[model samples]
Target: MQITIVSGKGGTGKTSLAVSLAMTLENVQLLDADVDEPNCSLFLDLDTKLVAEAKIPIPEINYDLCTLCGACSSNCEYNALMKVPDQILVFEKMCHGCGLCSKICPENAITEVPRTIGYLYEGENKEFLFNFGSLIVGEELSTPVISQLKQLISKDKPIIVIDSPPGSSCPMVETVIDSDYVILVSEPTPFGLSDMKMVVKTLRILEKKFGVVINKDGVGNEELELFCQKEEIPVLLKIPFDLEIAKNYSKGVPFLNVLPEMDSKLKKMIVDIGEALE
Candidate 1:
């Protein structure tokens, strides 16, 4: 079973829940798909090695035999290419590497060159297999990095858990689309509830099976519970707010070690997901 844990926004205990679930389960493969800000490895103690480098093609213009006909610029959906009177400007960071600019160049002046966007690392121990991507600073695109990391996964594993990026954008969608079940982690505050709606909408649009895991459960959690009940969405599990867990997080420790009571609940959540899949 492939399971992805995501949140409506950042700092809502998404990684905490994912790490807890991964540590509680046996022989699971974990992928931290948040290339922009990957912190899952901080809590995991494993012998890690750089497995691969992720790259994307960016346009390289040859000005020798070229005329700035503006065809490439017009064809670019992302506005990555801009044609001035004497020069064509290429914004490497804005480029999606679609190769459309090169194909549409009438003078064949555009060529593609590989640019490194991120590095893929793999780590493992007796319990779980771990892999994550670390995107280069100031790189605007991350889908390619996430794609490369997904390609490196061994699909034969019994359970695969993904720690997805926050929000309902392309990166988050890419991470969750392949999962058999997605656990949307949320806090009890108003901000969490609002963003959760957006994520839930995205999941429905993608036709994905998902449930809610209320993290940092507290006084305002009833609002989230009411919303879930109204939508008829299953409330899978709740990780309560504890100062010790927060302290452990700050010290780069997995909270599962201290909160041993959550182990069975997390295991039961996995079983529930399996049963729902059936």
Candidate 2:
């Protein structure tokens, strides 16, 4: 089974929980799909290697065969192409690599070329297989890189844990959409509740099965729990606001290492998720 761990916003211990949960499970494949800021590797000691480069096809204008016909520019949804009187300008960063510009070009002056947008890394130890993607600086879109990362998922493992990007945007959606289950990690604060609501709405729209894990549970008001109760959303586990957990996290340590007691809880959460899936 594939399980994606995500949050409504950053700094909510999403990656930390994902890594800990992966370590708790057996025969797992862990994938960090947060291309823009993949930090899951920081918590694990794996000899990772650059396995593949994530690329997207961008339209390349061939001036030799070209008439500066406005067809390519007009059809571009991202405004990556612009037609000037003398020539056509291609803005590489803005392109979504949809290949529409090339297809619409009447003169066949546009050709698609692969542009490296990110890198994919793979690492394995006796515990589990690991993969993560890192977006190149100045890249506007992350969904393509995430798409390439998901392609590396080896179904050979019995369990797959995906560390997804925060928020309800395209990148996060792309990461969790195909998962068998999603674990939404949120704090109990007001901002956390607000953002989690947005993610809840998105998951409901996508018809995805998900549960909540309230991190830093002691600080926030009871409203978050009340909301979850009213919505009938399952509360899987709660990690209390503790100083040792914070300190370990700062030192790039998984909470499971210092708080061995929580390992059983994490395992039970997975078992609960399996029961729910059935």
- 127-224 in candidate 1: lDDT tens per residue? 68999998999887888999899987776679999999999999999998888899999998889999999999999999999999988887474889
User: Against the unseen true structure, what C-alpha lDDT does each candidate score?
Assistant: 0.90, 0.93
For candidate 2, what is the lDDT?
0.93
The digit string of per-residue lDDT tens for model 2 on 140-219 reads 78999999999999968999999999999999999988999999999999999999999999999989999999999899
Model 1 — which ten-residue stretch has the worst lDDT? 214-223
Which candidate gets the maximum lDDT versus the true structure?
2
Candidate 1's C-alpha lDDT?
0.90
Per-candidate TM-scores read 0.96, 0.98
Cα deviation at 271, candidate 1, in Å, is 0.7
